[model samples]
Target: MSYMEENLEKYADPEMYDHLHEGYEVDLKTILKWAKQDGPIVELACGTGRLTIPMAQKGFRMIKMDIK
Candidate 1:
């Protein structure tokens, strides 16, 4: 398998992955501060967007890009 696919397969259990990664989620308050700004936010190699989605939820304009 490709490297990315291999790693994804390792984390196939969503509940386990979510539980492990959830702590890395972006703090809503921090995101809100950046969202208050007018500049666009870009997360290169954004993984699974654990941070990106939350920032987006707070009305932040975030562009998430990941490459395998």
Candidate 2:
């Protein structure tokens, strides 16, 4: 397995991983605006649902998946 796959759980747990991002915010708005589509969205590496959760709350259909 790849190093990331081996350590996937460490990154997958929100409680364990969320603290790693403490204050960082991903700018999904610009990406959304640029895409010009509300989705059905396909999100890769959707760690802790950071962007995915909000977009889903906004009513976009999200397919969230991650290898880690």
Winning candidate number (TM-score): 2
TM-scores for all candidates: the values are 0.55, 0.62
Per-residue lDDT value at 64 in model 2: 95
Q: Write the per-residue lDDT of candidate 2 for residues 1-68, one digit (tens) a residue.
A: 89867877566567868788765655786756654354488889887788888777877888899765
Candidate 1: which stretches are off by over 4 Å? 1-17, 26-36
Best by lDDT: 2
How does model 1 score by TM-score? Answer: 0.55
Model 2 misses residue 63 by how many Å? 0.2
lDDT of 1 by residue, 1-68 (tens): 89978976845665676678777645655656645548778888566677778788767788898664
Give model 2's TM-score versus the native structure.
Answer: 0.62
lDDT of each: 0.71, 0.74
Clashing pairs in 1: none
Model 2, C-alpha of 47: deviation from truth (Å): 1.8
